[model samples]
Target chain A: MLSIKDLKVNIEDKMILKGINLDVKPGEVHAIMGPNGSGKSTLGNVIAGKEDYEITGGSMEYLGEDLSELDVDERAQKGVFLSFQYPVEIPGVSMSNFLKQILNTSRKVRGLEELNPMETLKFLREKVNMIGMNEQMLKRSLNDGFSGGEKKRNEILQMAVLEPKLAILDETDSGLDIDALKVVAEGVNALRDGERSFVVITHYQRLLNYIVPDYVHVLHEGRIVKSGDKSLALELEEKGYDWIKDELAATV
Target chain B: MQQTVIDINKEAYQRFDALFGSFEASLNGQKSNPFHQIRQSAFEKLNTLQFPTLRHEDWKYTSVQRILKHKYVLEDTSMTISSLPEVAKMPDVDAIRLVFVNGVYQSHLSDNLNQVEGLSAFSVEDAMNHEVYNKVLSSRLTSEVDENTNPFFQLNTAFSRSGMFINVDKNVVIEKPIQIVHISQSGDSPKLSAPLFVFNVEQSAVLNVVESYISTETNSENPVLNTSHCFYNLAKQAKCNTYKLQKLSDDHYLIHDIKADQDRDSVFTSFTADLGGAIIRNNINAIHGDENILTNLYGVLLGLGTQHVDNQTLIDHAKPHCQSNEWYKCILDDRARGVFNGKVMVRQDAQKINAFQQNNALILSDTARMDAKPQLEIFADDVRCSHGATIGQIDEDAVFYLRSRGLSRRDAMLMLQLAFLQEVTDFIEHNGIRDFMVNNIVSSFEKIV
Candidate 1:
């Protein structure tokens, strides 16, 4: 469902992602592990069509359509979702309204029937309950004065409501307690299926325990140096990233 | 030192001298009437009071030199109050109707409000002819004029010809707000009109006044100037709410001076929304006269084109245990400029006072300008007084966040502006008034974005 060939990205004229190649098919989950400044989050943002990053050279195809030609909203409409590392607080837009707008916009862009207010409300309630958020939280302004855990849960609720084809979780586990991490993972696990795919990006392997990725890739200096099964995450967590850095240096 | 002193009060003295020489003898003859005597005293106080300048801490960012330099001819005779344009078609609001055309009462356009029990509403002419009007003004306009803080108010009394007077009897809760409509019309020439409005709330009585300014005809080349002074008096245990809607055209300049006095256990709430006018200056002052008094003031100014809106507010806690809250917001687009100055003062004896003030502005374009200053002066150390001011563009992150949800860029900006101004619009107590305010806000947004 997602494919990238020699993806290169530059921010402020400084190369962040150089020659990154990855592919994820439906019915599978992929996890990317990298140390600080290893270009893990930068890859996710570039895929999500952030305008600040210049895609120097790349061909990214999602669901048989060229992703580079689309803007952020267009990419989102095509079932590409990015869970931001930091969820922005919009002071006056309610969570339910924001979620409804996203869902309807996505549906409309795909030539699907749009849900009415009542139908949207029902969908939002079910997702709210599934994500363990109170109805009052949905009524308040989006992310305004919300705790870190609540903001992460809010992002997960949005993902569930939109039901995107490919979701890139970027540091959703950071700043979350163990309980919050489990809740967020549970929300992600609930959406796991043969027709949906996920790209989990994190430094720790703890979130992988709950989401349970099918493949693990170690990213270093904007290149995927190692690729293996789920056990690779466990091994990297145990020995840390230096072991992989040493192996790459020895190979070079 | 002598040169500096002379330069300090140059503009103020010129204005004072012009007004004094124009109407000193006429005001002296009308002192036999108590209201006229009060007016005369106010004129004397205007002479003693000095106009604040950039040196003043609160007026540091605002410049009023141009306003003071122009010698405005205060017209006494009534100008033609032409029929208003059919654009603003609102249903008849069931309240006491008072009409002022170029600062003169237009009896033809007013309804007979005397039939309403316990409610006395009429133009200054009605009060001038009736014996009971003297009684109402004598009991209502009973304020010892403050010279320093409100010099323009005294000037209003010194120059105002006819005024709007309303009295809600004791223990009578007025359901429908008293509506006073002031309309300015452009004729063959430009004109200047100064009107003074007074509303007296008896003990335990509730009064809501909806005062709106509308222009019947707008001529850019021959524009008119309309200045208004309004004083509100709430007795012990009385409640009063004032909502002023300024929707004049771009061909008009309005200067409004509003003074409100709250007695012991009284509550005064005011919401001022400025949507029109070429240049509008609003000066609002609320005084908590006794202990346990409460005061709340909120304002929103949405301007487009070359419109300029300036709001200055002062809340004085004179007695102990008073509370005051102030919030003002503005949205400016094109070449519009907005200014806000909110000052909260807690007196020495006014211990345990609680006062909070916030002034926030959002500039939509690079050419738009916003000047906001929130000032707090606390003589008593035991009071809770805080003030904050912010001038910034809309949050880029929030805009991007909304745009990612498929809202067009223009729609996202309009939503943000609406939410920013709704904080003040929601303070309208009456449903009809609130709807009117909402519609006005939406129209202003439409013109800009």
Candidate 2:
């Protein structure tokens, strides 16, 4: 569902992601583990088409079409979702209104009929139940005063409503309690299907316990240094990134 | 222009001197009093002071260059209210009705809301002619006179022959609001309309006053100068709420002066709405007479086309433990212009005074302009006073978030604008007026959308 060939990205004059290549097929959940400054979030943001990062070289393709040329909203319409590490708080825009706008706009792009206010309200009730979100959250402004866990959960709820083809959860495990982590992972697992995929980016292997990945990639700097299966997550949790760095140093 | 000013200045003095000379002969020296003499002295003092030019500090934002060019005819012609251009139809006016046309009173169309007991309304001419009305005008106008930097007050007093005055007796609370309506039918011809309001509330008396200015006739592209001087005197522990809605024709020019004196423990709240006029200037002053008084001033301006609106407010904390608040918002579309200047002055003996001023504006179009200056002068050290101003366009992220939900770009923009203005509209105390404003806003939004 997603492919990247030596994608080099720069923010300002500094290089953030240099010569990185990766791929993920449908129904596959991939986890990328890296330490601080490993470009883990940068890779996800670039793929989601955030305009801040300049694509210096190479290309990124999603479902066999070029993704680098698309805008953030256009990418979102094509079923590419990004669970921001820090979701922006937009005042004066209600959460339900924001969610309904995104869902209907995305559906319209896919040739689906628009939903009335009543239909949209009913649609939101089921998704709210799935994430265990209070209905009051919909009445308030978009993430105006939400807690860290609530913001994360709100993102997951949006993912469920949009039903994107590929969702990149950028450090969704950070700043969340254990119970919230469990709920979020469960929400992600519920959305899993044969035609959908996910790229989970995290610093620890704790989230891997909930939503086990089919492929584990060790990202050292900007490139994937090693590729393995679920056992790799357990290994990294025990030894940390130092063990992988030592191994890479020896190989170099 | 130098030669022209010299000639116009001399002519102006001669014109006024001849007119007052005729009035003095007609009165036969009947006007005699310590306060009336003081008013006459102030009127004399105004003859030497020039009508403010653009070079003046207070008049810098609003230009009256065109008014200075034409010679205004001081006439006694009365215009019927039916001749006025219709906007929002006036509500059923069951209260006291005060009417002013071209700065003179029309007693035929006015009714005294306080005809029963402790309240009374009268025209200045009748007040000056009859002993009863003369006593009320002389006592109220000269007693609460604000002898400050404003020259318009002196100009109005000097030129005004007839004014309307309303007084609520001590300890008497008026149930219905007193309505003062000034209808102008002056065309491109230079005109001066000096309408006066005087309210004296005794201890514990409550009063609500709603005033409006509407032009009856005018050339759509020309200017008509209209001036007003209003004074409110609230005794100790008295409370008053005043609202001034300016919906005059965009072809009219206005100079409004509002001054209020609040006694100890008194409270005053004022809301001014400016949605019309080619050039509008407001000078509002509030003075706390004793300790522990509260005064608030709120306003909103919606300007379109080339209309110009300027609001200048001054809050004077004269005694200890006084509080004052001011907030003004302006939304400008097309090439309209808006200016706001709010100043708070805390006197030397005023300690523990709390004052806050905030001015915000939204520019809906690229050509629209807004300027805001919040000034504070504090002579006391132990006080908490703050002021801030912000000017910006619509929030892009907020717009995108709404657009992503399914609303078209236009609908989303309209929703954001409505939300931005909801705070000020919430302050409207009259449901009918509030709904009328909302309907106008929605209709205008359709064009902008």
Q: Rate the local accuracy (lDDT) of all candidates.
A: 0.80, 0.78
Tell me the tens digit of each residue's lDDT in model 1 across A1-252. Answer: 899999998999999888899999987899999999999999998888778899899789998888989877777777888888898887766677678877787777779899999998998899998988898997798898999999989889888987888999998999999998998999999999788999999999999999999999988998888999999999999999999999888988
Instruction: Please write out the lDDT profile of model 2 over residues B1-449, one tens digit for every residue.
Output: 36564466566656656655654555445456333454465567667565666678877777665444555555454544543334434454344556667766666766655574778765555555556556655665655444455656776675665665666777887776676777767654566676666666778888877777777666744455677787787889998988777877678878888888899999898888887788888888999989999998988887888989999999998899999988888888899999998989988999999998888898989999998878888899999998999998988765654443334567677777766665566676766556655555565556563
Query: Tens digit of lDDT per residue, candidate 1, span B310-407?
Result: 89888988899998888898988899999887878888999998898888899889999998877677788788887888888898777766665556
Estimate the TM-score of every prediction.
0.84, 0.74
Q: How many backbone clashes does candidate 2 have?
A: 8
> For every model in order, what is the iRMS?
1.9, 3.9
CAPRI-wise, candidate 2 is incorrect
TM-score of chain A of 1: 0.97
Writing each residue's lDDT as its tens digit, candidate 2 over A1-252 gives 899899998999788888888889998999999999999999998887766688999989998889977666677778888887888776656788778877778789899998999999999988998998898899987788999999999989999999999999999999999999999999999999878899999999999999999999988888899889999999999998999899999998
